[model samples]
Target: MPAFPNSCFQISVLLLGLAAGPGLLGCARVVSATTSAAAADCLVYVGTNVASEQENTIYLYRLQAATGTLTRLDAQPGGAAPTYLTMDAARRHLYAVSETQTFRGAASGGVSAFAVDKKTGHLTLLNQQPSGGGAPCYISLDRSEKNVLVANYVGGNVSLLPVQADGRLAPAASVHQHEGRGPHPNQTSPHAHCILPDPSNQFAFAVDLGTDNVYGYRLNAKEHQLAPAAAPAFTAAPGAGPRHLTFHPDGRYAYLINELNSTITALQYQDRQYEKGPAAFTELQTVSMLPAGFTGPNSCADVHVSPDGRFVYGSNRGHNSLAVFAINPGDGRLTLVQHVSTQGQTPRNFALDPSGQLLLVANQNSNNIFTYRVDQGTGKLTPTGHSVEVPSPMFLQVVSDFTR
Candidate 1:
């Protein structure tokens, strides 16, 4: 860690709004001490999409850990419609999906790689590869972080790319096309929404909005492949349109957010014989994401579990709110806790800081981002009174407890 200058210390104080508080008593030492100890700053990355290609960018913001105040740091031009992002476990590199229908004259989207600057928290483009599909919507690293997985909406396929040692990317090593459709008009064709590796890293799952199914894959990390598991597809309710799936910290249960029906289903995960036997998911309970009598058009976008595994959070686009649910430890059932407004429109994506103390939301239609304080005991959220104007903010990813 490097020593922060007096000016840097002063700016940090201003950003944190602690000019005359007990926390500032050590301001003099902040200039000479390590940056992390002095400011407790974290880095937040915002991905945006606009009509103009030049306006698509990945913006970096610094989060004051104590106050949850976000200060703009820098921005870099990302390729077309960089809507989703993920960082490696080492925090040395980041990957984003260019959500476009065509890349380099081919009928496929692109996955871009960037190196993370430790000191400035800036990103520099390393290389890009075809996502092996069109209109890629989500990108995530496998548990090993040695491979990148992508879900393409228009192409209805999932792709795997090998991560090079230098943080660059290689072309797709494998691509699996989904086959099916649903009852909804939006589900006329298969749409792969997101692919996430299980905590164990031995298995991965992809949720399809069009097919209303969650497909399982056996991760072949050494060979850089995603082989379909013995039981490949877990069917959801007709017209449910399952979009995103998140596993609990204990890995015994998984939650599926259905985009079309505005409901979340809790499922018990049973990996019988590891890689040899098929992974099974038995639906436990299904609950509505919207409040009673609020029968308006709404869609589900994202779902995440609390770091402590005590709560589940899901986003509703038309409802413009976050639905919080408490998890029953014994049976892995969900009980509705609260429905809090995101303070803006179209809550497309939200992320909890690494410390699990702050929740940041990106309101796409309103073009703003809002922060809320998390209550560890109650698993509820309260507005932090900190908001920033970001043009068409689509997704937010926080690198909590960041030094730079």
Candidate 2:
């Protein structure tokens, strides 16, 4: 933990004053005290793609927790086209996928590891390994933090990489090639979009957009391997192109956002196993992410459940809005709440701060990040009018000091 200078403290106080009113007197006090604490160094990391004009890099920013303001800290060269990033549970290591078709002369993507400097929030490259597939787009850590799982979009496969004690990635332990296609043109071949471990840590779900199915894999922590689950896969609509999946905090329900159709499906999740069969998930309902009669072209990119599990949100690319939904506590169903504009175009990725009080959206086409304040009670979002310009910002992640 470090102390801020007098000038930094004054600036923080002034910004907090402008963001909150007298009605938030009690909250303001807590925020001020927390921001002043030596351990209040929150960090934000943004991953950008390498285009003709853009460099493959990961930019670091220091977050003013009290005001949702981000101050540039540093930038490091991420390997070729870093599309997605993930941090280890200890917050000491960062992992990113270099979405390339060739790695070390092989037809595969690459994953790089970086060591996080807690004091300055700087990242230092550690090592790199083959992603076991081509065009790896997503990476995530297992609940045990013993392995890193990656999804390859172009190769349509999922791979697991063992994590070493020093935070470097070992060669992939296993790679599972996906099979099948969907009705959409983009589904000519398999396209694994996201890999997320279940809350129970017993299973991992890989969403394959091209297959129109979510494949489940049983995690073997001891062996550091992944095997097809007893209940292998859950099928979506013909051309749904399910891209992302999220689970309720209670672990009783899950939601999937379909990119091709711009719809979300709710499912009842049960972890119980019977002598006759394995655990299963039952589809509960499906709802459109767009407004009625607004039949323009749109695609969904992200989905997340609120910290409280009382609400869920889906990001629409063409609509340039966030679709909010209220969660039914009784049956895990969802009801449309509101659609709030993101104030930018092509919001490729967004993240909620550690406190769940603020949301930041990275608009790729607009090249700006928009901030929004969350209404905890009603599950609505209001723009905070706090935005920062960046280049080709595709992924945003928040790492809290406390977690570190």
Candidate 3:
């Protein structure tokens, strides 16, 4: 009998959930966080997606901050393709987008709300409301937590949904449509990928991948509405599909990940109240998220700044790595720090724990999640040598209990 090729062997091991050597393939197992004397308890919520309409569930796990171990806690029935999730500031509620084109007989997706059970880390379905668009891909809470903003990838629009007092979602109070296109083949129409408020909470920005535009809006928290800003849009380079945006904690800088071009653009933000609007943004520098000379198909997914605002991290899908960069304190420029393997395939999303000591990555295609220990002085990630197996884990949200 002929021996299997190395690539085939690795694929077979991954599919069979067999143990494999380090740096080659991840082993499958049901592991949880164990308690240690110095452990801080953290609740991790993972959203999953599958190819079909088969009901997928959102999983809850208990994370031991000291050990970086994850133990399964509970599972809630998340509707079809709950691909993205966001938690409120109080950690009392969780919101996720059911990424489907049809919802309750309407040609729109849905956003579901869940009440977080503090004791058991369980989630109870609060309610779900029509997201006012089709294929809602991203969801986020405004700075004031009074409204939820959703980006519709297929509908080419963004919507603001009012949050009820009981942590439920109301119908969209305002919907804004994006119009334009980019040079990429995927940019045949507008695709609003993500929307969130700036650090000042006075202006919200929507990154549209299909249009290569970052649109700004005046956030009216009182009325739970969004209006176009004076500086309505900042256009990125043509064919550079901006997927997500993250602001520096200092509120002086913003980072955008371009999915089509595999690059990150750093911009300086001004929050001075002008007569027309309250914010302005100017591009500082654009940097590549991949190493030189290794040309492979890659798409950038998520971009996030460390809690201390000293580092920036972005996810690479085809490259299956996390690119880390150090922020220059003087000018808010980025210096490449490291590119570490995500230990699995297609790391579509990741999150940094509140303490900033741990980073969790969701390997969407490999059906697993991995943890890394972060170095504070240098923005480097060291694998914790720990992983947990879940089916099609697409997003991760960590709610930390630092008091523990």
For all predicted structures, in order, the TM-scores are 0.89, 0.88, 0.88
lDDT of each: 0.81, 0.78, 0.80
lDDT of 1 at 216: 79
What TM-score does structure 1 among the candidates reach?
0.89
What tens-digit string does per-residue lDDT give for candidate 2 at 1-404? 12111110000000010222233212222232323222233567899885873348899876665566777888889888887999875568889998888898999999999998856678899999999999998898887788889999999999999999999999999899988898899999999999977766666779999999888776665688887754445788999999988778787888999999999999987555311234346789999999888877899998888766789888999999999999999999999999999888998888876555677888989898988777767888888777888888988877664323
Model 1 lDDT, residue 164, Cα: 90
What count of clashes does model 2 give?
0
User: Total clashes, candidate 1?
Assistant: 0
lDDT of 3 by residue, 37-132 (tens): 122346788999987756789998877766678889788789878988988765688899999999999999999998876556677889999998
In model 3, state the lDDT of residue 395: 87
What tens digits encode model 1's per-residue C-alpha lDDT throughout 1-404?
Answer: 12111110000000011121353222122121112323334678898898666438999997765676888989889888898998875568989999998999999999999998866768899999999999999998886678999999999999999999898999999899998799999999999999988766766788999998888776777799887654454789999999988888777888999999999999988765333344358889999999999988999988988776899999999999999999999999999999999999998889886656678899999999999878777888999899999988988877643342
Q: Report the candidate with higher TM-score, 1 versus 3.
A: 1
lDDT of 2: 0.78
Candidate 2 wrong stretches, greater than 4 Å: 1-41, 53-55, 273-279, 402-404
